[model samples]
Target chain A: MTTAVLQERTHYLNNGYGLKSWLLTKDHKRIAVLYFITISIFFALGGVFASLIRLELVTPAGDLVSSETYNKLFTMHGVIMVFFFLIPSVPATMGNFFLPMMIGARDLAFPKINLLSWYLLIAGGGFAIFAMMAGGVDTGWTFYTPYSTTYSNTYVIATALGIFIAGFSSILTGLNFIVTVHRMRAPGMTWFKMPLFVWANYATGVIQVLGTPVIAVTLVLVFCERVFHIGIFDPALGGDPVLFQHLFWFYSHPAVYIMVLPAMGVISELVSTFSRKPIFGYPFVAFSSVAIAVIGFLVWGHHLFVSGQSLYAGLVFSFLSYFVAIPSAIKVFNWTATLYKGSISYATPMLYAFGFIGLFTIGGLTGLFVAALGIDVHVTDTYFVIAHFHYVMVGGTVMAYLGGVHYWWPKMTGRMYPEGWAKLSALFIFVGFNLTFFPQFILGYLGMPRRYHAYPPEFQVLHVASTAGATVLAVGYILPAIYLAWSLRYGPVAGSNPWGATGLEWATPSPPPTHNFDRIPVVTHEAYDYTAVPQEVEVV
Target chain B: MSSEAHAHAEETLALREQFDTAEQQKDASTLGMWIFLITEIMFFGGMFAAYTIYRSAYPTVFAVASSSLNVTIGAINTCVLLLSSFTMVMAVRAGQMGKRNMIIIFLILTLIFGCIFLGVKAYEWNEKYVEHHMPGQAAFHLEGTPLQGPAKIFFSLYFAMTGLHALHMVVGVGILLTLIVQTRAKKFSAEYFTPIDISGLYWHFVDVIWIFLFPLLYLIDRHLPK
Candidate 1:
């Protein structure tokens, strides 16, 4: 106990004092906190926008706000949620905090670049906030040109610039992750011996590096078209607007993988740990992530099936889109098989992982419905499309993100959260999320278009249900914020390897030292080798 | 201690705490620069794809507008950029050989050629301004042009692509100036010249972009009817 106390005394939290230590920190863990705090604010702001959008839709009329305001609300909701919150949620915070620890490195390959990436996110957020303050952009998060470039009397350039700057931040983080994975692994840590979380992130990093720059250039063209009257995507000036969709979705579609792949990684960790078994078909799961990232790029044309593309092109894209789902199915099946006949525990993380699988399955299956030409003609730009993405992004990624946070909270804060409350919140989120989005699937099939302030009286019942569920889902999200914060002072001190996990991160002290490991770990076994005998040893 | 031993000690001092050895650090840095270059390719690749699609759609207008650009100046600037890239290569070689004076001299030469390329670009842009060929201005009007709309687009892309290349050149100059100051400060020796090598990579990359831009913009319709 004395030695545990001594180790705790010098951990990362108390190693330094004051704001400067935190703000200027080159430590990947501290940088993760910087990202965490910023993205949390973005989440709150996005949630407020979401709440307003829902409240306005609770009736058949636009009662709460003007139509323009409603449009701005959903636009900000998506812009803040997708770019500011979801994309950075897992990879920046958890990945940065844990990737080095998992690989047994003192720090990321380029610690200063990691810090710069966080700052770039903030600077980008500043531009976005400035644009919002100057009157928000109303072109929606897709920023489809013609409306965005030539017509919308909103702050399009400022918002696009914000997203553009943030793209560089993503690129730099991806670069850091790739190099770290390639060059920073400790001796004896072969590629397959590395944890699935690292593999998932490596795949996400590849997408970030290769896919983000295209968007950066795409937005640059948008900026030029707006500011300098470049004729790239404007039909009035002899350009094809369909080309805009092609280029935008070219990056933005793979961007969906960017948002979910890291969360899939977190779920891989949670399912294996809570089930007390190695992941089933580990190589298949690892390779599927890479497959998804690559295959994701070829399926963007599915978004444009209804956009006057050639009939033959749509057929090819539809076929490719169906092909992309095979890898995702493989992951889901592997996770389910990992649970069969295993010692499964319904920890809060496990509950949320279960939530992710159920919701992502519904989401992924519906993606095919839209990927088909005939069905997409009926459902594209409707609430069904909205519901489909929310399921995958919100239900899938956010659920895994929360679950991973709970599973790692003890290690992150050196304190155990209240398990009963955490599980209750998990249940709240699952039930509330279904209530929120499941009705929209029906509403969208009924031909209700999205981005509207008013709809038919028949749609009111579903919208009301979604609004009510949003309130519950909001509570589900807020509970973690309350308890996780409260646990810092009042909860039990969790020792290293509290769950008796097998990864190198668990080998260090809970709340690891400034340099992640006192001595670099040499890997000698495959990931999730739970059958090995245990012995307690000081990391240093 | 012998001078050789003293130099070995200095090399050890140059190693960072994060790396296990100098070789690993160098390899990581080189790989990182290569990855960054790939992103740059993708960044420019978007515009290239756009240009290709539009150019194929209106080949005659694109060729006519291509002829309007001064091929002589474009050809000269291309040569100038190629020379700068060659000098950058010499700078990297000098750094590898520990010839500090040669490194400095070659780097300055590269910087000079880069400036000359920019100066020629500014002069060409000035000529376009006088001829009312710049896009987005009220005075902008293409005269006696076939497919005026497509011709306008060709100029729009010409400016956007080359203008972006110029912006990269400006950034390159700033980086070279920093490297120059750092070299004078003796912050690097031959054993610790990763920054110089990476800068060489970036400089050569900028030249390669112009190599593509020169052909696509200046040489595309050289044989077309004036």
Candidate 2:
């Protein structure tokens, strides 16, 4: 297969022309591409702030930027990365592209709403970007009240409005997925017969539907307090600031699962396909995603443990937090078991899958330590918490995201990226990620607090080490951006099933037609049925 | 299927391209609406949770502030919303029975009733404003309470919740207007009345929320005004 063949037929790309077609497109795949470009810009913007934060932290004093600037830098990094980048990272792009096709459907249930979701995210991001340009907001992404509601002089209202508007984007996507999965499955594609990725997204949809609105209303209150002096969270006006934490964490915590669940789903497919076996304990794996979402809600209280909550409440929350790890541990064990006694191939996606398993495990275990009352008291506001989430987020979700992109890049663009370069970047990410955050664990345990630009001279070595690793990680991240874009123009044309995967998505051309399929497919076999797909082996 | 047959089905049922059958499209839209309503619940639930915590914290102050509401007007608004809900049900029934004129009539009735509810709400808000009970105002005070702080908190929540519910009613009225236009345009029939049905569900859902809100916010003390 080659580039000449791509011009012969009209897929989603060639069937349409100009910005009008793309901007007005209701096609899920095109929307995914739009989301991909939009979120990538956001990622790079966040990375620039992260770089400045790292540069400032390298020395014992805040030399690169003022302490206030440092505060804005880290806050913007967390805000943009969490909301604009990670929350919509996997689900908006990959899930949007693949979930419908994987379920053997023509498109999502509501394409207009899907497009509306993208626009909402853009509108929201526009507000955040506006706030950033107009001298950045200093309130952290958490936006604890009194500081946010009473004291802060930054663009809290603009940023909070951005998040509030974007939250509807998430809710609409969730509602679309819930309706689509329930109603759009092809004739024989029963709930049990669906791909694990779809299952992963379905669970994510549940969380987005059930959890996001609380944050939306919470932001509304914050905005009201800031503008109208509503005093819902102002202690001076007979309001409890701690109640803000309760409301904020109520949605923000499960929001972690909202970011990670789709990543886990992507890994399930990657691991099973590369290992060439059905994922072991399929039912358990499927149910665990839902269990994690359900239990994820109850454990938001763990975040409030060190916030002067009741001692008994802390105990209850700590215990429930431990239960969330059970489902997570179940998923890890199941993935490991799926890899056992199988023809394992370490493709780029598989490398990311392996990295995701290791990092998410470490992230999840450290999660338990923080969930503990006494340990949370020790490390509540330290660099340890920062390192812990970076491991889960950057190490777990970002790795899985990059891996899924590599795996699907061919199918999406009708071109294969330079596999050798992809492999190199994956390795760089794996090694650089560890070097960046592992020292932060030690620094945190040694009592280095987070969000502070200046630190004691004793912490300089670890900070310097972390800074060095960040430089490496940046290179690792930039390589794919260059190579993947390069591949779109000049790389070899991809075949229908470049990876020999066995999902409905791979049954179409590399870049599928506007309607996705000439005829709707009927599923008869179980998911990850290696024997049903033709026998082939391609290692990159 | 042939293009002619497809065109005929499109003319009659207006099936969407993504759905394979008319029934599936209907089910999907209904489920989508229900899920959307669920998100709306969670949105209101956040404020309700905050209100619950505050109410428990300032029971006596909250009771006095609750009494500050005009219970008679509140009771009248409740009846108007309930009547609007009844008209919405009749509109949906007319939709099922394919009574185009009847659907239009009932939706108009629902709209008028919703407007009446909103009008009374506006008058009540004006009364609060004139009485200086609005939160954040320097002159703000409830006549029967010296605990000015908790009273402000109570008014803050009162305006927030009812204001949010009124916003939903405004949206419902907009939807009603659209439905009336569509009915006049003959876009719906007995065979396809989902837009009307789901709009009815939404109208009723708003009504139910008020049913809860009226008791919680306006009838907390339930003593007759002197």
Q: Who wins the lDDT comparison?
A: 2
The Cα RMSD of model 2 versus the native structure comes to: 1.2
Span of 10 residues, lowest total lDDT, candidate 1 chain A = A531-540
Give the winner by DockQ.
2
lDDT of 2 at A440: 96
How high is the lDDT of residue A507 in model 2?
A: 94
RMSD, each candidate, Å? 2.9, 1.2
Candidate 2 residue spans exceeding 4 A from truth: B1-5, B223-226
Give the DockQ (C-alpha) for candidate 1. Answer: 0.76
Q: Across residues A344-409, which tens digit of lDDT does each residue of candidate 1 receive?
A: 778788899999999999999999999989999999999999999999999999999999899898
Per-residue lDDT tens digits for candidate 2, residues A99-176, read 999988889999999999999999999999999999999988899878988888999999999999999998998889
Clashing pairs in 1: none
For all candidates, what are the clash counts?
A: 0, 0
